[model samples]
Target: HQRLLCEIFNEICIPDLRSNINVDRILTLRRQVDALKIHRETFEKDLNELEDKHIDKKRKFLELNEKFHNEYAD
Candidate 1:
């Protein structure tokens, strides 16, 4: 009877311990995901700003090129 009780206790407690570990892992993964999301947003914003600057510079360059060609046209 004592051995049977011990077996029953072990069966119940082991699964609870395993579930707790799984929950901890899930929480850690969720925190990592949140951090990655923030980083991705920051990177995307920086990329967009760089792209806008590049477009503006390209437009200015094209305008200058056109003006030079028009002034020197024979």
Candidate 2:
């Protein structure tokens, strides 16, 4: 009777077991997606800050170059 019950359970419960496994996989993927989004936002913010700094430096350099040329042009 035990073997018969085990066979019955295997036949009846396999689908449920497979569904639970799929649910776990979906949850894990969702968490990974959220983490990736956060990483992307941080990367974008850092890139913007670097770009702003570069622009500021370029403006300063150009201004200084113009001043030097004006003061010493022969």
Candidate 3:
């Protein structure tokens, strides 16, 4: 009976414990990492857009200053 129980446990329980429990934990971590990557990408895109807008505004300001200086001869 002891040998039979050992055989049964080796066949069923160990495989279930190793495969199901570990796989669940690994998959959960993978999902969280993927979500974090997406969140980081969104922030990077927003920062790039803000930088582009700032450059555009600065260019316009400089161009207006040049125009006024040329027109008034100052």
Candidate 4:
């Protein structure tokens, strides 16, 4: 009788164990999103540094060009 009751409960209620499966999938997606966010922030920081260096180089080049013209024009 006990075995029969266990079988009946499983037949009626056990197939919806999918909720746990979906929870695992949701957690995995959340972890992926966090990893992508970290990558984006790192890329942004590196890009900003490169842009700053480019601006500094441009400024130095202009200053040298102006000084050369002033000394040679006379």
Candidate 5:
């Protein structure tokens, strides 16, 4: 009985098990790769936008400060 059961399992179950495992691994890896790429792109764009805003704000503040002091001094 044990030998018969082992034969049945080897013949019928092993391929199904291995194929399911391979499909699951491939699908999970693909999803992870896609998600990582998307996240990286978003982070890079966000960083660029923040830096641009910071530079603009600093320039405007400096201009306003110089104008205020020059007018008050005159």
Candidate 6:
């Protein structure tokens, strides 16, 4: 009876502990994936805003340059 008790305890308790560790690892990985998705969204929004500002600036510079050339050429 004593030998059988020790055998069962070692087999059951050790595997249970290992399964708990695996669960904790899964939770940690999920949190990191959520964080990366949020960061990517923020970065895309910022990139779009910057692109609009660049187009506006370029348009204004061309208008001013054309006006200056016409006035001086006359």
Model 6 regions more than 4 Å off: 1-21
Candidate 6, 1-74: lDDT as tens digits:
99988897775644465456666789999999999999999999999999999999999999999999999999
Which candidate ranks first by TM-score, i.e. highest? Answer: 2
Q: Put down candidate 1 lDDT per residue, 1-74, tens digits, no spaces.
A: 99998897775644455455567889999999999999999999999999999999999999999999999995
Model 1 misplaced regions, further than 4 Å? 1-21
Q: Between which residue pairs do clashes occur in model 1?
A: none
**On residues 4-23, what C-alpha lDDT tens digit does candidate 3 reach at each position?**
88887785644455455667
- Per-residue lDDT over 1-74 for candidate 4, one digit per residue giving the tens place of the 0 to 100 score: 99998887775665566556677889999999999999999999999999999999999999999999999998
lDDT of the structure predicted as candidate 6? 0.90
lDDT of each: 0.90, 0.90, 0.90, 0.91, 0.91, 0.90
Model 2 lDDT-worst window of ten = 11-20
lDDT of 5 at 40: 100
Residue pairs in clash, model 4: none
Off by over 4 Å in 5: 1-21
| Model 4, position 7: C-alpha lDDT score | 89
- Residue 63, candidate 6: Cα error in Å is 0.9
- TM-score of decoy 3: 0.63
**In model 6, which residue pairs have backbone atoms overlapping below 3 Å?**
none
Q: How many backbone clashes does candidate 6 have?
A: 0
Backbone clash numbers for all candidates listed:
0, 0, 0, 0, 0, 0
Looking at candidate 4, the ten consecutive residues that score lowest on lDDT are 11-20
TM-score of each: 0.68, 0.70, 0.63, 0.69, 0.64, 0.66
Model 2 lDDT per residue over 1-74, tens place: 99988897775644555455667889999999999999999999999999999999999999999999999995
- Tell me the TM-score of model 5: 0.64
